[model samples]
Target: MAGSDSLFGFGKGPPALLLFLAGMLISNIGRSAYFVCVTWIALTWSNSARLVTILLFTSTLAQFLTSGVSGYFADMVDRRRLSVSLDVVRALVVALTGCAIAAKIGIWVLFLSVALYSVVDRGYLTAMQSMIPALSRRRSAIAANSASYLVMQAGTFLGALLAGYLLHTLPYGIGLFPIAIIFATSAVTLSAARTELSDPTHANSIYSKPRFQLRFMYHLGRHRLIAPTLIYSLGFGVGFLFSSLLAAYVLDEMKGGAVLFGQMESAWAFGAVLACLLLISGAGKLLADFGLAPLLFLSGTGLILLWMIPGPITAATLLVALGVIYNASRILMDARVQQTVGITEIGRTKGAINTAATGTGLLAFTFIAVAGDTLAPSDIFAQYGLLVIAVAAGFLLPALRGRPRSHDEDRSA
Candidate 1:
């Protein structure tokens, strides 16, 4: 797999990249599992859709405030070390929160834990994305992004499946501590891999001259990244429509419990894994041009379909389709950003994008939190779907990519 044209499509990918992606798998598994449990528990504790939305709103708010700074930090220091440290911190957060839950502490403890985890999660993710250019042996960043996200989607699928089983078999609080253990293991796994920067001078260039600019968001127009950034941000934002409300949709509308919720989540995750696998295999090249519109339209249609026909089977099937659409859009955006941004600026660029995405997510959470009492979860899902559909009708693909690089970019194709 370390050859010039490996299965990952990234020619000359280093062993460290393989190791890093392995670590990513472990970490995503933990993250997905932990959140699945947390959301279910939060709902069970409060028995209110409004409270669940508020809880998720707290996580998005935390990300909104710190994402830009986290981006800068990703470029300022050693990304590997920063990520390892953040993972340790996240492990502690999750562990303590688990203990708090076991002790029947107030909901504030859960909120505090999620908020802290949210901040660290942003930096951890940004650092991971920034590391791909350095780790992929100066080859196609799209290939590297696909490989990494492919691993991520697979891990989430497994984790959701695990969560589904655990939620049914295990005690509520017992599931949270295992996530801490998984994160801690990921930290150790990541620490074992070295950053194989082929061009150390340029790859490490961001440390010498750091970028802490907030106006980069406004100036994305100058570099011709704003269109893609805005479009992807919209795509990213609509995800909150799922994360914040899906559990409630399962419980209230589908009339299901934690096991059913987990099943739906796992189905969605498995579909995402398949999508990433398709992209990584270079079979999705034609899909690259179909752009975000198809993904958005598909998502909107799936959500609306779920609303129109509410059943456990329907939700699971529709979620699988929606998940594929969502991850395909994300893979496109990630590959686009990696192609456009140089290594030194990649961190800040991703940071800016994440901040904007989180802002939109925050708005979604707030809306659901405020209006949760009055609306069915499926109703909100349909509304959000329609909103994106309207946007989809007017939107085209962003000019995110320049001409393909003259190197190994399309080698697999």
Candidate 2:
């Protein structure tokens, strides 16, 4: 009876929820630090931009390649234990990598180590996602995810904001300390959390040989849920890809450097934080229940404008608006995916969905950083905006066609 859902009325109580938020905040702080680490380290080491992007790409590429396998293992494994151990390993790996960089180790070795860390890091996240549904009851799923995302947005903004200051003031080697500390904290918190009650649903597996792998390709081809989710991911990723190129447009072509870039990222982060706050305050449920499609269309339209617009002030305004709407839509869609899919295929369902998004990012990064370098920024943004609009159309038209006769009605029917 003590282990039942009465404690929180629906799912986990205060203690488990606190731990969950802490874990996500710490993990996301590490991720945010790592995202900016490449450019910072490159500046300190006098490395090529290509090399920096290559290292970042190496990490994403490895994660993309292994994501499906990681998801499969997540469904089969003891996710909490797997998550805890991996965090510990990641902390040690990152600390050692930091030390090596401080000592001026071979660049190739540094890259290889970071790549190895990426695999572990992403693998742990996959396991964690699989575990969340187990830790909390079904009714609390949305709250849990919203809380996690809020923490993540805060952590990411704080990390990136601090990194900007630290790279200027502190030595690059010393800058990695915060990342190490966060992962260490995450490891400790998760290990302690293991002593709590294990939910019954997740208790049955020590690697069940689910028909997942055997029937994976067939399910992917036939599943109504998976196909639409992939397309939606593609649309979102394309929008983000265009946004990434927009940054280059501002810095190089707009003739504004650090000052403009800093302003834009800060504005973008602020909007994200404000949006998350609104969601956690119960405003999001109102929006979700009432204006889902119109809001989505607004987000897409905002992204299109954000990409094509010139001038730092104007573009930043558009980006702030776009970022908020985009994140809100993402949260809604992700929840829908979980609700729509068969429980047995959750891992592959999400993995297939994620794969397309991350892959699109890789493609976009490669194209923008490489081709945008050769072309005019105006031309790049113009072309990129068109591409994003085209992708968004695929999602928008169908949803409209399937839209309920009234706002109060469910769109899924």
Candidate 3:
């Protein structure tokens, strides 16, 4: 019954916990569509690889440098106000980006606006993540996280579809209408969530002393922080490489075009949605730590196989499997973080974790920049595969011996 309660998100928090989840799904739809439009427009407008790279790199770089600070603010501020304000900011930014495109604005303007949008996006996510524990008990937190990510992934797929439809059939400026509306809806929906998310310990103590205080350092060293951090870094970093290389893989290796590429993306996003669905089931607790190592190993094997897999149909099918494996790993790892940390520390813990993951992502991008020209897309996929397998190997021993102790356990020892 407890598991069932958690599965449905009927925890100790306000009823608006359900509202929070709904807002996540809705906003993500807009977020995903807006990014797709930005990327597509940038490529169409510039037709320059260097410019596109600069745009994307700016967004990633902003996250790498400031995720920690954003998380810090997420913790210190009233999370409800912080999150709702960020949602409004996002809506405004998305609308503004659309206007820039419609008006034929300077490329530099697009760059600056998207970079600012990028910063706000990361901060909004950190604030929302920190709110999960603030709204639920441990069991409920896991299920809620699973639910949260499920909708978010589904939103991504929906948004991609919306972008494709609008781009293919409608005028360019039409995209501005729906995105702004979606985010505004999200802001209104989430604002109704009543909860006290700020930590008094943080506000009152010397530990609250701005960024990188002694308090954060102490939590940074803990295993609770380390576990999720490593998992996120590997999953996100490798996943980003996959997204970047996938187009080339489709074009060159599979001899496919936009149609096949779209189909493959659908399959992958579908897999992620399916993963979250399974994770939110009655067996949610078992789902969090279950099969994580094996999932990574399987992901590596699939990536390696792509090095030789030849058919577009076959490639798309394989992506379905890989998507499930990769996203399940991400969702479960996120749940583990929520399980291990308390309301007060979850913000900074997540911030540090995201910083590490972004650093890993940037490193992956650097590797591509430096070596991408010489390597075939297949070769890059195999290299990423090897990295995943290596991470899996490291987890293999610990997984077999049984789940390692959390930081709290070490402290009690």
**Clashes by residue pair, model 1:** none
- TM per prediction: 0.90, 0.80, 0.85
RMSD of each: 4.7, 4.6, 3.9
Best of the candidates, lDDT: 1
Model 3, runs deviating above 4 Å: 1-9, 12-14, 46-53, 106-110, 194-202, 211-218, 248-260, 282-291, 372-374, 397-413
Report lDDT (CA) for all predictions.
0.75, 0.61, 0.70
**Strongest candidate by TM-score:** 1
lDDT order, best first, reads 1, 3, 2
Q: In candidate 2, what residue range of length 10 has the lowest lDDT sum? A: 404-413
- Candidate 2 residue runs with Cα over 4 Å from true position: 1-10, 43-53, 106-110, 197-211, 214-223, 235-263, 283-300, 342-344, 369-372, 376-381, 398-413
Q: Say which prediction, candidate 1 or candidate 3, comes out ahead on lDDT.
A: 1
Flag the better candidate by lDDT, 2 or 3: 3
lDDT tens digits, residues 327-377, model 1?
Answer: 887877777666666777777777777888888888778778879779998
Model 3 quality (TM-score)? 0.85
TM-score winner between candidates 1 and 2: 1
Query: For residues 35-94, could you state the per-residue lDDT of candidate 2 as single tens digits?
Result: 565444652354243455555567667777777777676665666777878888887877
Residue 182, candidate 1: C-alpha displacement in angstroms: 0.4
Give the residue spans of candidate 1 off by over 4 A. Answer: 1-7, 11-14, 137-139, 195-212, 396-413
